[model samples]
Target: MGRVLLAAVAFAGVAGTGNGLMGQDVPLAADFPEVYRVGGFDAPEWAEFAVPPDVRFDAAGRLYAMEGFLGSGSVVVIDTDGTLVRAVGRPGEGPGEINRPTGFAVWRDGRLAIADMGHRAYQIFGPDGEFERFVRAGSVSDPLGGAGSMGSKLRPDPAGLSLIAQGPPSGVGALTDLFGELLGAEAPGEERVDDRGLERLDLRGEAVSREPILEGWRPSTAGAEPPELSLDDLTEPAGMLTMMMSGQRWFEPGFLWDVLPDGGIAYSDSTAYEIKVTDGAGRAIRRLSRDLHPEPVTRRIREEVRERRLRDLEEGSDLGAGFRAGSGGNEIPAGIREATTEAMRTQIEDREFHDVIPVLTALRATWDGAVWVERVGEEPWVEFGPIDVMRADGEYVGTFAPGATRMPDAFGPDGLVAFVELDELDIPSVVVRRLPVKVR
Candidate 1:
C-alpha cells in the first residue's frame, strides 16, 4: 500500500526560487503521507542538500550532473555512483559561467542547453561539459507556441505567458555576434513572425533543421492571472486556493523538450492528466487522458453550471435579466449555448485540475525507453514519484521515486536515471539511480 506523508524531519521548508519575472507565485502543501519511499537512491550520504538545477547521465552510464549551493550560487558536477566530479560554473554574471542556471537539457545533438534565467538564452554546452554557444530565441511571439505548457512533453512547460507576467515579453531574434553589426535593428529587438523554423540537434552536436513538433497546435493561456473568478466562488474557495498557492504554482515552468529530430513529439499535459502526441509539423496525433481518479467536488460545481444554463435555455424565465454581452459583444444569453460549450471546455481542459500536479521541475527520457518526471513533494515528506515508465504510445508502464526533486536528466535515453537534493539556500546536490535492465 502507498503512504501519505505531510510532515517529517526533512519534508518541511521545501523551497524553490523563481525568476520572479512572472506573476506572483505561491507554493504550499496540503495533506500528505508522513513516511514515504527513501531507500532507492544510491548515495544516502550525499542525498541531503538542494541540488543545482539538473543532473544527467553520460553515454557510459556515468552521472554527470550540476549542483548549486543555492544562495552560495556555486554549480558543481558529480560523477556516476555518487562521487564529486567537477565544479565549473558559479552564481554570478561571468563569461564561461552562469547566473542562477535553473534548467539543463541534453539534446539528441549531444550538446546540452542550460537555461540561465538570470541570463536569458539557451546556453549550449558540449557533452563533455564545455561551454559552446548560446541560442537566442530573440523574442518568440508565443514562447509556448502551439505548445501548451512550459514543462510540456518531457521538460518544463512554459506558462503564464503575459507581457505583465514575463517582464517585457521577449521577441524572436538570432543570437547574432554579441559584438557584430545588424540591419540597424537593436542587438535584441521584437518582431512577431511565424515559426523561426526549427533546428534538431543530436548527441553528436550535429544540427538538423526540422518543423515545430507539437500537434493539435493551440497557443497556451495558463499562467496569466486566471481570469477573475466570480466573487462568490472566490469567497468560497479562497482558503483552498490560498493554501495551495504557498508551495506550488501550477503555471510556472522550469524546463522544456523538443521532439527528436522533428520526428514526433509526446508529452504530458499541464495538469499531468494526459499525454499528448504531435507530428513533426506540430499537429496533435493523439492524446491519452487518465481516469486514475475522478474529482467529485470540481465535477459537481461544473455540473451545476450546466444545469443552470439548461434551465435558463429551456424555461427562459430565470437568468434573462443577468445576460450581458462580453467584450466581443456576445451577450451572455440565458440560453448561453456558446457560454456553456466554453464552460465545458474549461471544465475539462482547465477548471477541473484542482488537485492535479503540475510538472514540478524537469522531465527526462530513460535510456531504456521510458519517461521520468520529478516534482517537489507530491505527498508530505515524499520527494518524488517513481520513475514513470510508459510505452512511447502513452501506456502507463509504472513509476518509482527515490526521493524528492525533478526527474534528474539521464545522459542518454537509456536505463540509468539521476536525482538531486537541495538545501535551504536553494543550492542542490546530486543523487544517482539506475535500472538493472540493459539499455539497448
Candidate 2:
C-alpha cells in the first residue's frame, strides 16, 4: 500500500486551492509547489551519446532511465507505447557493469534505487531485469573538509593575530548533507525487511543520512512547531520550497532548492552564493542574498577564472630547480580562496548543497512530465550558464529550459518522465509531461 512512485503531475492548472481544513493533514500537496518545465529531450543523430544519470517510474507505469555514463552504459527501458524496451547495464564493475550510473530511486516497496556516480555505489535493478544489491556510496567528493581534509576540518585563520583570538570558530562546520535518494525500507518494521535497506546498509553507511522527509512531503505537519522564518520569508515569490543542487556542474555551486515541501528537492550548493528557503517547517526561511549573483557569478564564484601571464623568458628561464616566479594558485588550479566563506555558512546555516552548480549534463526525464534541458544555451561553452529550470511545483508543472538534466533522484509512477536519448543510450523514453496542474 505504500508504493506510489509518482502520480504527481502539476504546474499551473490547479491554479487555486489553498485554504486547508479537511482533517487538515495536509496532503493536497503544495506547501510551496512552484512548477515549471518543458525540456522533453530530443536526439536525432550526432553519433549518439544519451548521457542520463537518473530518473524513475516503474510499478507498471514504466519509465526508467539510467544510462551510466558515456556510450553503451545502458538501463533505458521505456514503454507506455513509447517503445524501446531493453537496455540494462554493461561497463564492468561486476553483475552487468554500470560503474558510472548516477540517478533513480523509486522505493516505497517497489524497489529501484540506482545511483552509481562512477561506482560510489547503489545498485538494485528489478522490475523485471533482475540482478539486485550494490549500495556502496560516500565521498561525493570532499564530504566536508577544509585545511588538511579527511572531512570536518578548518581552523587556520588566527596565524597573524589580525584575528588570533580563537575560541569558537573551530574548523568551521555543521553541514552534513548526503542527499541519499533512498537506501532501504526505513519503517513498516525494518531490519532488512528489504524495502531498500538493501540488507541493512553498510557498504558505506551514510545512506543519505537518516532518510525520511516524504511522508506527505513533511516539513511541519507531523508535529508542527517551527515557523519563525527570516531571510525574506524564504525566497518570496511566495517563499518556502527549493532545490537547486547542481542542476549540473559546469556552473557549479548552486542547485538544490527545497523550501522544504518534500516534493523531493536538491538544488546543489557546493560552497555558496546561497539561496536556500526551506519551510514546510524544515525551518530555514529565506536567504536569497545581497549578492546571490546578478552578475559576476554569485552562488559564490561560479568557477571560471583563468588569468595567464607566464612570460616564459625561456622555458622556466633555463630550468635548474625551475621556480618560474609568479604564483597565483599555480595557474587556474580550480582556485577560489577564502575557502568559500564558510562554504557560504554551511549553505545558509548547515543545509550545505553540493558539487557547487552547473549541471544539465544533457538532460533526461520521461515518466510523463518531460524535462530534458541538455543545452538551452545562451552563454555556455567553457562554463557558466548551462541555463536550466524544471520547477516541479507538484510534479510536472511549468518551466524547463535552461539546460536541465533534471534527475537528482526519483520520479516515476503516473506522471512518468524518464529520459535518455542520443540514438538511445541503452534506450529509455517515457515522456508524459502533460501538465497544467492536476496534482491528483
Candidate 3:
C-alpha cells in the first residue's frame, strides 16, 4: 500500500472484455473469504508530539515519522517494537537540521533523503542517522529551475536519479499575481496556470525530462477570488459563507497517478473506475477496469456523513477554538460573534452535495506489479479493507483484506509501513507488518 511502485513496463494494447481485465462484480462479503490479518505496533505513552505528518521505512525495517510543524519539526526514529529510538533534525539552517520537511524518500542505496521546503534543499542521511550531504531541491526565484514546489513526492530510481511528481513553472504574470496575494494586494483579472505533470531529475539537480499528466486546480487563495455576490459588499460575512462551500468549484477530483519503477505511468481518471497505464514512450497500452457502481450521495447520506465528520473533528484533535465553538471563547466582539454563527448556519443550509461518489478514490501500483484500486467504502471515514487487485497484464485478481493495517505511507523489504492515529489525543504511531505470502 506504500506509494505502490510497479515493476516492468509494457506497451501492448488489449481488446475490451476479451482482454480478461474486465473485473467481476462480486459482493464484498463473498470476495474476501480468507483474510490475511496482521497485528499493529503502537507508540509508547511516553513519546508524544504536536503533529506527525509523514512516515517512512528504510532497508533495515527502521520506522521514521516526520513530527511537528515548520519550525518545531523533528524526525522521530522508532524501533520495530514501536519504541522511540531517537529524534533526528530540528529547526535550523545547518547541514542536518531542517526547517520544514515536506516530503521524504529512501534511496536505493539505503540513504534517507528529506526535502526541506524552507531551505529549498534535500538533506541526505545515512542509515545510521548521520547527515551525509544536501542537494538543492529547486529555487523559488526561478519557477522551473529544478524540482518545482515543496509538495512534490520524491521517488527513487537507478543511477542516482529521482522522479518527482510536480507541476510546471508558473508564468511571469502568475508569479507576479501570486506575490501580490501574499502581500495582501488585489490583482484582479490576472490569469494563473498550473500545469500538472512529472519530472525526472538527475543527481546534479537537473530536470532531465518532463511528462504531462493532467491539469489540476490552483489554490483558491492564489491571487484570484471566487465569483462576486451581493455578500461581496461586506467581505467578512460573505467570506465565511463562500469559504464553507465544500469541494472544488473550478476543477474535478484529481487522479491518483504515479510513476512505475521502469519509468511507466499508471493513473485512473477521476470520473471513472478505469486505470490507463502507459510505457516509457507514453503510449496507452492497456485500460484496467472493474465492475463497480458509483454510490449515490443522497441527501440523507450526505447529512449523516457530514455530522460524523464534524463530531470526529470536535472530539478527535486540538483544532482551533474558532472551529469548536462559534463564540471563540468570548474573546471576540459581539458583532463578529453574531456574524460568524449566522455564516456557519447559512453554509450548512445552502450547501449542495454531489449526486454520486466516485467509484474509486485512489490507485496504487504495488512492488509485485499489482495495482490496488481503493474503493469508496460504505462508511464515511477512510476504510482499510477490501482493496481491488489487478495483475500486471491488466487482469482483475479480486479484492484483498487490509485487516489491522492502515493505508501504507511507504514500503520496505519487510512489508508495508502504515500509520495509525490514536483516538482522543490523536497521537501518531507507525506499524510495519509483513503481508501474507498468499493473496487471499
**lDDT winner:** 3
For 1-440, candidate 1 gives per-residue lDDT tens digits of 11111111122121122321121222222212221112122335333333244454445544434443232333344444445555445556765566655445543333455545555444566656677765433334323221111110122112211000011111111112111232222432321222212223222222211222222222243443333333233333232232223222223332233342234444443434444444543345554333332223345554554555456555643323223433225655444544444443333333322333343344544555444444434432244543343444454443444342245444343444554444455444444544444221
Residue pairs of candidate 3 with colliding backbone atoms: 4-365
**Model 1: runs farther than 4 Å from truth?**
1-53, 67-75, 108-110, 117-119, 134-263, 270-273, 286-293, 298-364, 372-388, 394-414, 422-429, 438-440
Error in Å for residue 82 of model 3: 5.6
Ranking by TM-score: 3, 1, 2
lDDT of 3 by residue, 292-405 (tens): 666666667777755764564445332344434433144555666556555554544544554567677666655545666776665534565457766646666556444423
Model 1 root mean square deviation, Cα atoms: 18.4
What lDDT is reached at residue 206 by model 2? 35
TM-score of each candidate structure, all chains considered together: 0.45, 0.22, 0.67
lDDT of 2 by residue, 350-394 (tens): 232222233333332323323322222343333223322233331
Model 3 CA deviation exceeding 4 Å by range? 1-49, 68-72, 77-87, 126-128, 137-148, 166-177, 180-196, 201-203, 206-252, 280-283, 299-355, 379-385, 401-405, 414-416
Cα error, candidate 2, residue 306 (Å)? 65
Q: Give the local distance difference test score of model 2.
A: 0.31
Reference-based lDDT, each prediction: 0.36, 0.31, 0.52
